[model samples]
Target: MRGWGDIPHFIHQSAGTLRNGPLVQFLNNIDITIMNKPADYSASEMKQISKRYTTVANQINRHRTNELKNQTIIFNLSESFANPNRVPGVKLKNNPIPNIEKIKKRTTSGIMLSSGYGGGTANIEYMALTGFAMCNFAQTLSTPYTQLVPYLRHNPSIIQSFNYAIAIHPYSSKFYDRGIDYPKFGFNKFFYLGNKKAPIIHQKKIGANSYLSDETAYDNTLNQLSRHPQGQFINLITMQNHLPYNHLYHHISHYKATVPANGTIAAQVENYAMGIHYTDQAVAKFIKEIDNIDRPITLVFYGDHLPGIYRNSMKKDGLKLHETDYFIYSNPAAQRLGAKNLTKHNHYVGPNDFIAMTA
Candidate 1:
């Protein structure tokens, strides 16, 4: 848990274009199919279908809005960004330990910041985020023993070792298409200008390196991170909740049931809930791993933003969108050792406020 301000020195770069990519194309198709139905359809039929879709969409949007609003409030309350006088809690061996000075000193020491849109944002956004985090962390640490290089070259082992060492979980890869660059170590960088519609591309993927899986891509990242043993903090961004609702839903159907009315709003809500449930399961696994770690570790897990499904629902329900929701769970080992029950910290907090709360 290095202090956010003390992160190591690192350069931040972005690549690729935002528009006309596979994701944008797919989203456009979905929008057209839903919003541009033939005008010739019977008014009664249209009314029935619209009512259902709108209902579901509205419910989702309301949920998202509420979540956003909550996050905003929490962010406002954080001392890290707003109030410097407020000290973050430090729990060692699970007790309400008063080492605020030590925590603050350790946090601000040698931290680096390399932020970009894609990787921190979602799966398709991975190319930018993962590459940047890895490169920056690597540059900071002295290299590990040279003998480990050969084992690191093995793709599967490389991926697993890197992730495990950094405490990054496997399911985090859902936000981006991993393995877009295999064999080679690079990211599928995408860029979008602030005022312009198109992207400025420099390097693009070619040859057999194009077909990488999310799992493998993550593995590659872990491999890269593992090269630096001196780098104490490795912050990872995951994309397990990115869109194409139906596709994401499929993976967690076991936790969900068919909607009663088939194409009705209630059904859509149920499906969305099911997807969230699956994400929860993934989070649970991460928590379990943290709890089992032999050394002291602080795990901070939270959503970057609420899912788009919830945004759509807000429109249908006519609710004003507001805050985002986040939760911070400590390792069970910390609890066992006398850590305060920080689970009660489950409240709406913005992304920026996270460092303050956990600092």
Candidate 2:
């Protein structure tokens, strides 16, 4: 991972004018025809439908704001529960943890962020990349990675906002049809688990599952940036610290859960804390590397969803299940771009605003 970052590949981005105009028009026409009352609509009707669809679709695209330039962005989606104490404005009233006040003291910087309930990572995954809710596409709520993604080709994605985009995951491509969806979403390439496994740091088990550490995932993303330093975005989704905290890791941490220390639930909570600690270390390392580097980078780091653990850290703090955590971390270059208010408190964002928040 260390050596990978030094190697450099210079990439120049070419201008992208809409490439699937006719295809989009065709789909829009179909949509219009389906919406209208069924009649023996002639070829002339189809022509009018096509024309209308093209006009409306074009109008939609027109609303797209400009992309941020000269800055590399990384949307790093770490797994599982993001303790709300880490963010400001979180309050615990209904379901307070045993020692939440002390827990809050342990929290670092950033704003509290959340995604909608259920649908696992795909819910926020779709929203963050496409900036359109799963509900927006209807079928997407059910089969985003499989059916919906393959069907929507050349739709507007934040990927197009950057000159180059790459998706990095340290796990199998088989899950969630990412191999198909990522490309269509405009990612230039991907770094994921395959025949040749990814080189990950802290690859040890946190609870029961063996995971590719967040540190490794982030480092690989930097490695991608090293390969192509100019005008790039890296979407790094991690797999470490997933769920099912029923068992123990081969090499586990002694960090105890803040809750009463004797039950099965206590064990699970402690396991999550230990995993969170490792994630925190990895994040610190990742941030340090960016700070020392010469590249102009803007990073959006957050949890995709809450881990399906019993003591949801949110419940302890009186927050909803949808609320996980998110933050935009940028260097000096990005800060100058009217993003000075990033560290400002009370951001309170959701998955749908991911695109706008980063920009």
Candidate 3:
């Protein structure tokens, strides 16, 4: 099978009856082992891979980490966040994300080359946490969270460097097999909507029919931060700006989009923009809340991917559609501790570069 999406059809066609539970389970295991088998590399290819890693190791060794010794790091992955202006023939009456735009001016900010366009949120998160580029993997190795992470014996990640690290997502933990995969990545705790150990403390949804707002996501993050006095690494994924952009918000932003499509797409675009606006305001508030804390703190914020809502614009924008916003900001406390020069301005980088850049 090409990817996880093909498994259902494969099972339907090959497995005649679902009544034989043991037989089905046996076949499933065989299929998984075959699909996720590691590639056989020649001696030359192995040499090249070793050389690449050695070079990376040398580059990392050259950097000084004294500035970051006392800083708490937070990775904020925003859902379906994109620059609306990237869409062709689209015109915004006003900027939907003024706060982020302003913050980008003075910090290490740039456009990240996202691996997926409309979806595949997990892949981006995987790269950010692991510092491994998806482009190096075989094309069939799609949706690694389901196809690969479970079978692996060890999954190395940035979380391993921290004594206290947690992941928080304001949605169901079951998505992308994260419920099974997070432990392998070495997260101390994973918080989500239905997690029994650390259930989501802030579950306030936005609009009449929408996912939880970023404000509540930040509240939960702050609660987690407060518990860890020394320091912590937080991976927060916000769901307020997620899909089904069909008038979820009561009042859409005034920033109008003029896609060369029907009214339905336009309405969706506007609603998505409104969600971005909310995130912008919520992020400003979050940054302010953390600024007063005495300890050093650094936040790495970025959009996962553009919303799949733009069918016509996706084709027109091409590679531009794959570029989303990213920025790294250290608060006053971190700056006071010689953290001002930790990150430099980068115009373009891949999602895999985030962990390396921050380190």
* C-alpha local distance difference test of each model: 0.30, 0.60, 0.79
TM-score of candidate 3 to 2 decimals: 0.84
For residues 1-359, could you state the per-residue lDDT of candidate 1 as single tens digits?
12422222111101111324444433333322112245677889989999999998788667332221111011011000111111112111211112222332323111112122212332111212222122323322221111112124432222221222222323312122221222222212211212122122122221122221223323333343234422233334433334333533343333333222323333333344444443344444444544454433444433333333332333443221223223444445434543343333334333433444442
- Superior by TM-score: candidate 2 or candidate 3: 3
| Model 2 lDDT per residue over 1-359, tens place | 22433211111001011322444433322322212334877899999999999999689668654346567888877777467333233222222222322323333223334543322676577778878765445331344555456676575778887777888888877577787778788877767776253343334444355776777777777677677878787888888777755564533335443442223255665556666667777776777778776767877777776655534345554355556756667776555554443344435666667676676
Candidate 1 global CA lDDT score: 0.30
- List per-candidate RMSD values in Å: 23.2, 12.9, 4.6
Clashing residue pairs in all predictions, respectively, total 37, 1, 0
Better of 1 and 2 by TM-score: 2
lDDT by residue for model 3 (1-359), tens? 33532233121212422433445534544444324345785788889999999998779768655534346999999997888887666667788999999999888888988988788899999999989888767665666776678778998888877887889998887778788888888788999988888999867877765688999899999898788867778999999988888868765658676776533377888888888998999999999989988888889999999888766545656788798999988889888766554344478888888887776
Better of 1 and 2 by lDDT: 2
Highest lDDT: which candidate?
Answer: 3
Clashing pairs in 2: 92-317
Q: For each candidate, give its TM-score against the true structure.
A: 0.35, 0.67, 0.84
lDDT of 2: 0.60
Best by TM-score: 3
Please give the TM-score that candidate 1 achieves against the real structure: 0.35
Q: Is candidate 2 or candidate 3 better by lDDT?
A: 3
- What candidate 1 gets wrong by more than 4 Å, as runs, is 1-231, 247-271, 310-323, 332-346
